[model samples]
Target: MQVHEIQVRSILTRTGGFLREGYSHTLNPYRGCAYGGALCGLPCYAQHSVWITSGRAWGSFLDVKVNAAEVYRSQVNRERRWAATRGGLRIYMSSVTDPYVPQERQYGITRSLLEVMLDEPPERLVLQTHTPYPLWDLERLRALLPLVPDLSVNISIETDRDNLGPGFPPHATPVAERITALESLRKAGIPCVAVVAPMLPIEDPREFARRLGAACDRVVLDHFLLGDGSPGGLRTRRTGFPSKLEEAGWQQWTSLEQFEKVCDIFSEVLGADRVQKSRHGFNTPGPGRCSETTTR
Candidate 1:
């Protein structure tokens, strides 16, 4: 068997205030990610993660954070005392590494953390993953449903194409497959938020939001091509998906205000009933305040 490895500083990072509220602490099962995505934070993975940004991230390498879950469990347990006395505890899963990548099929650290949350009961456990395949650990989600009721899922995807999958490393499930998995989670009564971030300029963004909203309880959109040209996010999907954004040359919007103008346009085109449009991005077309309940 081939051995893959990487080195890193700390596993998780607490960045972005207010938005990063509650789920500041994070955990990654693997040191590097398998479904190497461009936006991923793993600086070691060459496909996406941090490698492509500046070649600082090594390519297609694996650094199995051996004591990943155990480490988190110990630390969280320690913090529980203070958390209980002070206010609440919220831990974001897989900030640097995906908590449910293929290797998880064997290690099961994410599952273990879920179990811990069930036993200890954190005020919130925000689970985020790019993979659409829903690994339903029902016993856990159900157990903490009441206490950690703030559990939010951010299933990230760029395009809903089966072939336009990520251009990263060895990941089997395609975009369509992930969409199904996420839908399954929703059917099982889990609150799931689909994040179409790094929104590549492809596949009629409006239509994409409509279709995704149909499947998920909520939708969140973010721009991807903020002037970073790299060759990383091709493992599970494709890269050129962003070219469509570059080619179309959207309507007149040059200054920073142009983005808000685009969001207004998106709200108009996608429809507030079918696609909720906030200054943030697209969301489940609903009457409720969207971003507050959804984003982590």
Candidate 2:
């Protein structure tokens, strides 16, 4: 992977379109995702964003915002002032790239951003990723709990099966390992959430839901057709994801029928109050808030 240390003019971006509902701003420490070649990136809607990619191949290059923390420190106060007039500031750590990607171990950009947030906490903060790298800052996260009014860690586990067959890029974290990370975060008294986005082929839905119930406070279930951030999943259709699923003999999962079935199964196991769907689920209040089941 080609890594570039570039400086960004801004670290916090105003949320709109897909993320407009719950969050006031979004913070991405990096431009391109290191896991862009991983399993999750196959159907990633972010890859289709030409403005961010700038014609670079997904996963082939990574632009690290070396001064992300500095930029955030400078702009956060002004942004917070602006947000206060409109609504309380709520920041989503990342929307396009994983905050805990592997490069984070060396650069510490995400860690630095969190440190700055410690000094200037937001009304609400959500850290979302599909990797176990968050454990690197467990103590730091614990320190922020009392400081940040609302804080939650969202871990995406798309499927129960660890392997999705050949031709797919290797996952950053295996299924079992990700669940273990969630367990650790929950044990640390951190608010944890399991995001099963674009629900993949699961060997057993009940067991999967049960596992998630034990690991996190609540679960968000979604399918590409409903949650791909496009009208009728137009962007996802442009990828080979559908064909890959079909080749794996899981074509039935390409439709909403299986997704709905899995949602019902999840509700049955995790309780309807704990089960949520798509954008509505993501926009729901942060951890420790009352739970409401979204209509499937």
Candidate 3:
């Protein structure tokens, strides 16, 4: 893997495209994801963007935004001054990159940004990752929570079966580890959510939901075809995921029927209020400021 330290003009970006409806802004400390070659990449819509691809294959390289924290401070101060005209900032820690990838242990770019946020908290902040590195800053997250009441930590664990992950992307964290982290965070009194994104084949749906309910406050279920940028999951189809499933005799995993069944089981186990389906979790409104913020 090749790593480059690149300078960026800005850190915070007004959420656009598919994310606009969910978040007001996005702060990606890294340009590309280290999980690029992992199962998560199979359905990642960001990989399809010409801007990120730049003629290079996904997950083969990483560009560290070296000045992310400094840029974020400037953006936050600017936003604070215009708070009256604008609206409370609900920033997603990352959109296209895993904020806590292995490279983070060396550069601490995501950690630095978290420190900045500690001083000036956003109205709502969601820290999403599929790795355990974020646990390194458990105390920091706990401290920042009091300042930012609407903060949430979402761990993206696609399936209970870790074996299936490497078949798609070679480097994703094990599903069990992710669930353990989720349980740890919840135990620490941090608001947590387990995101079964691009919901993969599970050995047992009831057991998965029961485990998730015990680990986190809520659960979100999504299918690759629904979240993929391509309508009807054309992007996933291009990757031959469906064909792979058929060959593996797991063809049922390729259809939305499986996703719907899993959702129903989750609702039964976790309670309908705690189980979120499709894109609903993203659009769910946080307790915002004293005004109605336009999600779009």
Candidate 4:
């Protein structure tokens, strides 16, 4: 993989589209995620974005936003002044990229950004990723909690199977490790959730929900057809994910029927109040506020 240290003019971006309902702003510390080559690569909506993709392979390159923390500091200062007329900033960190990728250990850009947030904290910060690296900054995250108590870290676990999928990337963290990370984070008093986004085929829906309920505070279920960053999950369909599922003897996973079935089981096991659906739950509301509960 090629690494490029690129400087960005801005860190916080006004969010729209699927993220508009829950988050006010989005911050991505890096461009092109290291885990992009996994099964997610097949249906990754971000890859369809011309700006970040730049016609390059998804995992072939990583652009470290070297000045992300510095830029965020200035942005937060400005946002604070602007927020008086509006409301507290609900920022989703790393909407398009994973903040705690392997590069983070060396550069600490995500941690640096968190340090800046500690100084001028937002009302709510949702940190999302699919790896165990968030444990690396547990202390930093714990410190920020007093300032932004509503902060949440969502660990994306697409399926319960250890194989992940038929053609998942070898470098991606194992399914069991992610579940263990969620348990650790929950035990550490960090508000966390399990995101079954683009929900893949699971061996046992009841077992998955039971495990997630034990690990995190709540669960959010989604499927490729519902939230694949396209009008009709066209990007995912074009990747042949449906055909792949059929060939793998998991054809039911290609349809929303199975997704809803799994969601129903999760609701039954975890309770309806504890199970959120689609992007609405993934982008939870700020502190002292109630988000409109939604399902799909």
Candidate 5:
């Protein structure tokens, strides 16, 4: 992969599109993702974002924002001074790239950003990633809990099957590993969310729901049809992802029918109050309402 260490003028972007309703700002530490070649990248919405991709292949390159933390500190401080209210600074850690991608270990960009947040904490902060790398910052997360009123770690586990077979890039973190990471975060007293986003083909919904019910504080169930940002999943449909599922004899998995079935199974196992769907699920009001589930 081509790696470029670059300095960015600003780190916090005003949240827009699908995420604007819940988050005020989005923080992306990098321009490209290391896992862009993996299975999840097949239907990745960010890959289609030309503004971020800059005419480059999704996983072929990574532009590290080496000055992310510094920029964040300056922006947050300036925003706080001019903001009309302090309660509106809800920030999503990442939308375009994984904050804890493999490059994080070497650069510690994500970690540095979190450290900066401890001093200038947002009203709410959501850290989302499919990798288990967050486990490396357990103590840092714990320390930020009291400072940030609505802090949660969202881990995505789209399917039960670890291996999606040939033709797909191998997954960086398997389903089981992500579940284990969720369990560990929950055990550490962190508010944990399991995101089954753009639901993939599952071997058993019941078993999968059971695993998530036990591992996370709540579950966010999503299908590409509803969660892919574009109306009716047009963005995802433009990719070869749908044809791939069909080739695997899992055509049924490509529809909302399976998404609803899995949602029901999750609700049954985790209780209706703990299960949320689509955009509403993602916007579920923070850790304070752990028992509340948004169906709309």
Candidate 6:
């Protein structure tokens, strides 16, 4: 299959309007995604409006957005000029697809993108990924980390039952397996923040938060239920259901009195300084931020 090199110097121009607004720009080396997540259909709303035709749902096909980096450099230059004039880092790696999906391993689009970002002075860079084991090119990430110091790696781990068996396919690995990937990233000094997103239906929600919180530098919470009321909603193998272990009222784990009840769990376990929650405003918003209250 021949890879198409499309030039998009200014990738994320209006992506901020949807979610992950903090990410002003995006650089997807590959067009489609490999994760094939259940909720993957939702966050992709902004992109779907333009690319998707049928509208049933976003398809999973990796069309290497080849010329992505060149255009990205140009956009960065323009954004830098805009930042110098207006002031602000503008851009996000991904809004629709995973920046480091399987296709990245071969084409190395992300690797090349890192080089370009490192060549410059540095700016605000936010990365979101379902897979955490990104050591394919350690030297590059390490080198770029210092230059792009404002980088925030959001590792997406929605629930404890990531193993993908019952309803989930075999392609996706279990959530437990990827948790350590975050640990490896933090150890690499890459500054990882766990995205406890699309919360799944797990055996225990409280313990799930405690465990994932312990691994990453910080935690961002996001609900799994998209609230679209669509059938065949997100599910798992271990529990045969979606994971919402970290949500607000699920299982009544996090006390309603105050957000502190939830924040304190990981804060006390992970560290008062590290553990974060959405309602608290003081803590980081785990991997996912479904709660419209604070995030919106």
Candidate with maximal lDDT:
2
Report the Cα lDDT for residue 123, model 4.
Answer: 80
lDDT of all predictions, in order shown? 0.51, 0.87, 0.79, 0.81, 0.85, 0.53
TM-score per prediction, in order, is 0.67, 0.95, 0.91, 0.92, 0.94, 0.71
By the TM-score metric, which is better: model 1 or model 6?
6
Cand. 3 Cα-lDDT: 0.79
User: Which parts of model 6 are misplaced by more than 4 Å?
Assistant: 1-9, 12-15, 18-21, 37-57, 85-87, 163-165, 224-264, 271-296
Q: Which portions of model 5 miss their true places by more than 4 Å?
A: 81-87, 289-296
Candidate 5 residue 79 C-alpha distance from true site, Å: 2.9
Q: Order the numbered candidates by lDDT, best leading.
A: 2, 5, 4, 3, 6, 1
List clash counts for every candidate, in order: 19, 0, 2, 0, 0, 30
lDDT of 1: 0.51
Model 3: residues >4 Å from true position, as ranges? 80-87, 165-171, 285-296
Could you give the candidate ranking by TM-score, starting with the highest? 2, 5, 4, 3, 6, 1
lDDT of 3 by residue, 79-190 (tens): 6554424456778878889999899999999899889889888877888898866788888888887788588888998888867633455538878888888778876777
Give the winner by TM-score.
2
**Ten-residue segment with the worst summed lDDT in candidate 2?**
287-296
- Candidate 3 lDDT for residue 142: 84
Candidate 1: where are CA atoms >4 Å away?
1-19, 37-59, 81-87, 163-172, 225-296
Q: How do the residues 142-184 of candidate 5 rate in per-residue lDDT, one tens digit apiece?
A: 8998898899999999889887777777776888889999888
